[model samples]
Target: MQTTETLFETFKNVLALSNKNNDPSISSERIAEIRKELDSRILPETPLAELGLDSMTMTWIIVKLEEELDVDASGISIFEIFDVQGLMDELIQLRD
Candidate 1:
């Protein structure tokens, strides 16, 4: 089983690769805030919406996952997965 810390670490590793351009426009502080949220609430069953992730941020996150991790997120409906564990499952598949 993946521990909470390991899961966040894995997510961060993939996210680091998500910035293909190394663009300066990306806000490091905002990313840090998200990381802090993930650190505090890494439970598998926790709903992302419950963590204050608005649709826009979620969409951006999915886009990055698709672009950087080669994950086919096109078919995914954010409403379907509904929890951190489901997102982790998708990320695991992409990693493989």
Candidate 2:
């Protein structure tokens, strides 16, 4: 299991890569920025459990992270990660 700090950084880096061009080094502010981007793009009003990431979006997230972190996010179960925090925790495990 990765530390929560590592999980936060993983989200930051992955979100940064999603933008196509940005610094990979992550920060809390960077993570918040990405959350805003997701809010705009997905228009999520509630938690992921209330509005799970669509299949295409889930695939994109995994693929993008795979490319950015060289981590196989394929093993992650999208259905199980029905919340933003869940997704972050799962990705952290994958990163390790």
Candidate 3:
């Protein structure tokens, strides 16, 4: 079983990758801001949409999780991604 810190790091990495690819010119300060917001959500049920991530960004994140991390996200429903913890749980279950 992966610890909470490990899961948070994975989540943060995936989001960072997505953000970098989506906006190559994004500043480090902005990235830090994003990370801060991401890190603040310690609760499992924090709504994903509340992160203010765009649809394209989410798609990239899912792809990165599936391809880079080998997390099987085939069963993930966009609507069912109700919280950060839920996504972490699914990733932990599907991680290779």
Candidate 4:
């Protein structure tokens, strides 16, 4: 039952934490750009491929999401996800 806004906020917060921790060395400028993009361009139905995230970054995000949500998302593949909504749906299903 997570709203899109809540999902976006969680995604943003996780990325911000990742940036602060230098887990993958995502620059502050890049984080700002991502924030801007998420606010302006990202939508629930928007294809994840359109976000232009590299595999490493996407993998890190997925790993962080798994930890944060307390779900076993190990089998989920970024390439298999069609959009943000689809990812959200998968996570919801996993949680159940």
lDDT of 1 by residue, 1-95 (tens): 45444655666544443343345476767666655665555567777667555565567667776665566776777777778778877766655
lDDT of 2 at 64: 76
Identify the runs in model 3 with alpha carbons over 4 angstroms from their true place.
28-33
Higher-TM-score candidate among 1 and 2?
1
Better of 1 and 4 by lDDT: 4
What tens digits encode model 4's per-residue C-alpha lDDT throughout 1-96?
A: 556567667766665555544345667788777676666676778888886677877878888988877888888876889988888888877877
lDDT of 4 at 13: 64
Compose the digit string of candidate 3's lDDT tens values, residues 5-48.
67777777678656787789988888878777666654466688
RMSD in Å for candidate 4, one decimal? 3.3
Please give the CA lDDT of all the candidate structures.
0.63, 0.60, 0.74, 0.74
Model 3 worst lDDT window (10 residues): 37-46
Estimate TM-scores for all models: 0.59, 0.51, 0.72, 0.72
Residue 62 in model 2: shift from native, Å?
Answer: 1.4
Model 3: per-residue Cα lDDT at residue 55: 80
